[model samples]
Target: MSDKPKIKVLVVDDEQDIVDLLKYNLEKEGYEVATANDGIKAVKVAAKFIPDVILLDIMMPHQDGVETCRQIREIPETKKAFVIFLTARSEEYSEVAAFDVGADDYITKPIKPRALMSRISALFRRESKKEQENVQVRIKDLIIDKTSYTIDKNGKILTLPKKEFELLYFLAKNPNMVFSRDELLQNIWGADVFVLARTVDVHIRKVREKIGEDYITTVKGVGYKFD
Candidate 1:
């Protein structure tokens, strides 16, 4: 925490081009980057490098992003790694799966370098801010520890990422306080941020999945809350 330490990044994908392009661009931005070609090796590299963040691709030869994320979650060393899913899947169901597996963010393929840089910058900014942030919140049965960045439901630890954890924290902090998507976007994602409402739904759905279905009540015409 003394200075901006080397930002180690591990990118996993089957496509050599994506890995090369990301490494080139991320290195251009001065981040220390590493690459892995599949889900299995991704775990190994992640343990070795303990990367500051991970850019994970969903489809690969042996294992896919979902299974890889599951494996990564199992390893305590990579448990807190900030992961972003880089893939070509744009379906709502696919996005929901990505969130369920602890993706900090989802960026589709055919990436624009400028927009990629912008989004990466946002993540870096958020990471910098999180350096001083505490990660603890207690709900009825859902307990969140921001310091360790772990969530516990009924005393069981639930894996979550920066954004999803923050979203849950915001909702838990104000239990029973209904928040519209606009309000949530402002409160959780910043007031000026722009993301599809489906993003919020995906996150909420994931939270519900981690804890239990029906743990979060949907407000039909409004937003969400912890039930």
Candidate 2:
């Protein structure tokens, strides 16, 4: 007999067999699991269940995962939910699109249970440490508290991921000094992380979306700034 707190996971897809497969394998790995057949329903289920992570299908019958992810960001309960896209799309654009919509990782479907678990575990480990920082970067109307990891815009609480918070933190620390995407990827996401330069753009877009549309200034071919 083994006793460990089960990590709750939400698997959203329109296909019945896929959902069942993921549920079976995830439970086998000692995780608690739930399911949703469409994007809107995914959000509803997530809100009610408060899953630790959400495995979303990019293409579904209603709403689609991209839009669902955008909406999930607006919900306080699921705002920081670890999001991974499980899709059949293989195009680089699809990958970029997934990140742009706020996914932490992407896995093409016909997913292997072991690989999925590995990726999920890695994200959990990274996030556990990320949850402990102290933030108090002052940018006009916005105040980011690193310890609490929350953004307040003119007294309103904002939902930002642990990674986005760090990106904003580094930029805010130097306010007006531009950092190249590669530089940001090294300093913020870590030099060891094999992620695309575009990932930084995705995170920045999400940060700007939450703080204000004009919060982050892009230097076009260069990098970004907090002016």
Alpha-carbon lDDT, every model? 0.78, 0.81
TM-score of 2: 0.78
**Candidate 2, residue 193: lDDT:** 41
User: Which lDDT tens digits does candidate 1 get at residues 53-129?
Assistant: 88899989998998888778667777777777888987777666775666667788887767876776776676677
TM per prediction = 0.78, 0.78
- The lDDT leader among the candidates is 2
Candidate No. with top TM-score: 1
Off by over 4 Å in 1: 1-3, 130-135, 138-143, 151-164, 185-217
Kindly list the per-residue Cα lDDT of model 2 for residues 133-217, writing each as its tens digit.
4447787777877766677888888756657877887788678899999998777645434567878888888787777777679
